[model samples]
Target: MHATQTPRQDDPLDVETFARPEQQRRFVAAMHRIAAERAPGSSVRIYVSIAPGDANCERWLECITDDLPDGVELLHYRTAFEGAAYDWDALASRLDGLVVIGRPKRLGSRVHVLGPVARLELRSLVATKPVLLFTHNHGLVPVVDCLSQVMPPEEAPRLKLIAPKRWNRESITIRAALDALRPTGVSNAGLESFRAVQAHLLTPFSAASR
Candidate 1:
């Protein structure tokens, strides 16, 4: 399969504009940390999970691709289980980790329904490897609640939840998930860097805006 190209730095969805300078630095640093831990000359492969008809899919792809470091590659997988069940096992074998852009439909207060296609990809990825879920419509808690109903209790820990609105509170969680993406003998400096700036990483971007 062909690799997804790095987004242009001048793109409208640039992470620099999506997030503040310091926040973008921290996020980029975190990405670089992941890239650094990879085996020498090897690239870190992360599967980006999104629905086929999602209007914001391109935005999401561009923003994420812009922030990633040189040694990290994103494999964009548009979930369209139209004809038959997808071969998730085969896909999982090729990915190091998953980044799911969840745009679940809000059903009621504190309730949301993760689309069938996204749910299937999450369930499959979480079972096979680590997954960092970015909830767009609602915050992480409700989306995690939805997943808990469908995902077995044992498989739940493999998933890390994040919401743009709650980035400050969840920055540490995001850092930890990135660390877990590819474990190595690297120091905890990256994690500490996130802690130092977690409070200032305010201003949620439009990607997670309702």
Candidate 2:
């Protein structure tokens, strides 16, 4: 959770050296917008779906928590059906966003196709909630890029996807996902002030913090 370099005041969104400055800036702006628009004292619940017993998936889940906004809460929902809730709609109703973790790298060039786990994840995304796809391996997340790779002319809602090479990048990517999910209301001057709040919340803290 410790960020080696503090963000420069001139560029508050520069939280990580690896992430593009523009992308980070946009991500920060979006996050602040959501916080400002969220109903008072009401949190946005993000459901994190993971395959049970996957060690790597478990680790990334723990690591990503370091950079989450205060109003965001992550709920762990395992995919395996043994004694777990299989009701996607009911779960969807309670969730504002979803993160699908621990996926296999696509073995071939089948973007529109899916496997067992990916299918389950896709079905859950039917509600059109903003989603982010992350795999334990630092490679392309085919699920997010699937539609794009298959048909260049077709358009789908922006789906955030990240496969971080390191823990720091992983946490920052999680922040991007949260920023994409958090809802924002239109405001004239809110952008300027919300930017400051995003900067403060994004400051690195102990993993135990926030």
Identify the candidate with maximal TM-score. Answer: 1
Predicted candidate 2 versus true structure: per-residue lDDT over 1-210, tens digit per residue: 323245567753233333444544554555456545567435466666665555555456655443444435566544323477677667677776665653344532111223355445555763344455544333212122222212122343222232322324344434545555554453435544554443443332324564
Q: Rate the local accuracy (lDDT) of all candidates.
A: 0.46, 0.46
lDDT of 1 by residue, 1-210 (tens): 111223365642221122344543444455566546667434456777776556776666656544433334456543323455677767677777776665444422222234555566777765434455544432222122122344334543223232333233234334444554543443467535533442222212334665
Q: What's the true lDDT of residue 51 in model 1?
A: 64
Task: State the RMSD for candidate 2.
Answer: 13.3
**Backbone clashes in each candidate structure, one number apiece?**
0, 0
Provide the lowest-lDDT 10-residue window in model 1.
Answer: 138-147
RMSD of each: 16.2, 13.3
